[model samples]
Target: MYQFAITGLYQQVLGGEKLNQIEKTGELTSSRFTVRDFTELVKIGIVNSNTITAFTGMWLAFQLNGISFIQNVDVIFFTIVGSALIVAASGAFNNVIDRDIDGIMERTKNRPTMTGKISGKRALMVALVLGVVGTIMLFMTTWQAGVLGVIGVFLYVVVYSLYAKRKLVSNTVIGSFSGAVPPLIGWFAVEPSFSIVPIMLFLVMFCWQPPHFYAIAIKRKEEYAAAGIPMLPVVKGIERTKKSMFFWVILLTVLPFFMFDLGLVYVILATLLNIGWLALSIYGFKMDDSIKWAKWMFVYSLNYMTILFVAMVVISIFL
Candidate 1:
């Protein structure tokens, strides 16, 4: 009975019209892997974004701890490169785990995993290699950062992807923990201790993810529903998702105040960014087209994180 049910599900997912479309597009045909395929498999964009935050944290740590970057260039190199590798590994693992659903979502339907450009076993091998090397590199910096890297991978691959992602509406929230760990890893690589600065940075990333992801959920509600993923927007409705986004944005607004060490420039810029995001969230309540509003929110969230993290590095350098 279980076998039959599994077969039925696969048939629904990969048979008939969808199969025709896959065949027509040559998506199911095995092909030689290319650099573009590798980038997609590892989700280079996500790696780059997370690496930026990690770099920001490391830079701030150097500034706050009065350490010379010239003296600790090795640590900086390892931390940045290791963070990127771990994040990329996580993305590859996610692609392997999510290939079934990836084929169903328009945005993800062309992923290397779904297109037969990279086999699942090969992807897993790549993930393992990247994760091991990344963890070792992090350990070369500090045990604290190494431990955080392992924790981040576990949260992302096991806790979020294997568990919460399909079973709970709070999956995005759960996944944010892993996403927030990069900066912590960076700080720990330099300082190897807990402090307000790193904690505030973690909180900044933590509070930023929900609203950012909720916007994606809203924009792709139908796909999420079809994929059987219980995203907040798909399960609870867009209005509820909007309210939640606002709540998170509100929480995010106060986090900057706690990091007064970042200087007045960071504070003001962060405050303005928060206000702009809050205003955008409020405007969502009035927008007739929720999809358009979600797109705006998603774009703003990207800009918000990029600008805020870059500003942190710049402020740490001059201030």
Candidate 2:
């Protein structure tokens, strides 16, 4: 009996250790998933690639001004990080505000906010911290940049997402204003002067967004309509939005010419990019399966902006 008791106790202790190990393993997995979810949530909110592009345009614009590398390195660090954080914060706030409506939209229904991957309260806290810290960092570089960052947050969260998004057909236009501000923030970070180049950059983004977003809106028309979102395509019909997109693309094409500082390289590239975009828009307008065309336009717009900005950087560096 004593021997049996000893064996049972030993088995129990071993089992207990195994259980503890399993618990630890489970906890480690949980921690990893949480970290991943948090990262995904940030990306979903900020649209990091687009944010980086806008920030890059600003940084390149500063470089074009002939600022020293040493001075620029630190400024680039603070400005990009701070601006990106603020953009993230704005995106998080948007997710929180739109969580309900987001659930109804097929494309947005699977988002962290919709799927409860992260709690809304936790998301808000993250946004607040990012916004405050980022704004402080931005102010360390330039007060103008900090202010522009704040304006971007307010416009995205309050003006565009909360007020305009549901109520106005011009919601894309309102949202574009926030998108355009990132480059301006970058521009003013180095050159506080309100110049034509920065304004043109802003206009380029502004014009680009309508077509970009309208294309998405067209592709997802039924979703927007079902979700009760007043997107241009949902409200204005496909043909109208297509016409609007072409008009914006034309404007985007012409605007770069006025930026004489951009030189032949940028002008040539911008012309090509706009022609392709304009041709695609015109084709979509005439196509029977306009949704497919819209999708093509959407993809092209992403490539268009990326190439245009890179061209801006290259010209700024070489010419």
Candidate 3:
């Protein structure tokens, strides 16, 4: 029953009449997701717990300030647990809302909600519970941080999911705003000060998302079309999608210069990275290499953001 309790379901696959027998379903078939299941994912490092839980740690690291390692533990527990709950809730709810749409798309057809492994009513209940718990955790940080968390939730669940996702061609843009706020939340966790630096960090992420998603839409155009989701590549042409991706990558490259006054190190490094990113963009459009190039761009986008942020943290120290 522990396994059943963990996943929140049990099944009764009975045999025919003559020798009818009841056998306990050994394998978990999912009736609902339990807290234990979600928490275990966080504990094991499958989904991201860092950006959610490490707000104070990121702030401390970015500042290059020394704090007792002991203190970090206390901070990590509260921030990670709280933010993770919210993220999980948001994710589960997104699955519930998009289940019908998801079933039409190849990539999402196997999700619990899409497959009828979890009920809509149950998923909604979990989302609300997790959101409330997450908000409470953020409240423990400071009212400002709590407000930011709430904004992220509201932006994602309501504005993006409900209103923009189905109606707008630029749904991803609205979604990116909420996604990029994690670093900002980290920036403000300790200091709670609004600055050009943190705002720039947000913009870099904000701008980077379009191209990243454009590449994805290009790769998954047919799935999106089948799903009746009007992604950029589906509504607009592939050529338009490529051009849009190129434009956004250029925008991401140019953003750092306006915000931070870094030395030649950043300038040279960014130029080289941008050159590579743009080259991939160009290859995606001009060459027959788009399928390969789109995948490359997607992979590199993850690293590029990580390296860029790390560079920012590094530059913040010496500059």
lDDT of 3 at 184: 65
Alpha carbon lDDT of residue 303, candidate 1?
98
Ranking by lDDT: 1, 2, 3
Local lDDT at 273 for model 1 = 98
Each prediction's RMSD over C-alphas, in Å, is 4.7, 13.2, 8.0
Give the alpha carbon lDDT tens digit for every residue of 1-319 in model 1.
3464334334433434654477467666466889999999999999999999999889989999999999999999999999999999999888877876887899999998677777665677788899999999999999999999999998888788767898999999999999999999999999999999999999999999999999999989999999999999888999999999999999999988988898988899999999999999999999989999999999999999999998998888887
Best first by TM-score, ranked: 1, 2, 3
lDDT of 3 by residue, 1-319 (tens): 3453223211111112211121123221355565654443223331363363235334543464343436656555556676666666667556555655765788767665534445555556667798799888877766776788788877776677655777788888888888776666665555577766667667877888888777788888899888787787888878888888888888877865765355678777776777789888888766776667778888888778667666765775675
The residue pairs in collision within model 1 are: none
RMSD of 2: 13.2
Could you give me the TM-score of model 2 versus the true structure? 0.87
TM of each candidate vs. truth: 0.91, 0.87, 0.78
lDDT of model number 2? 0.76
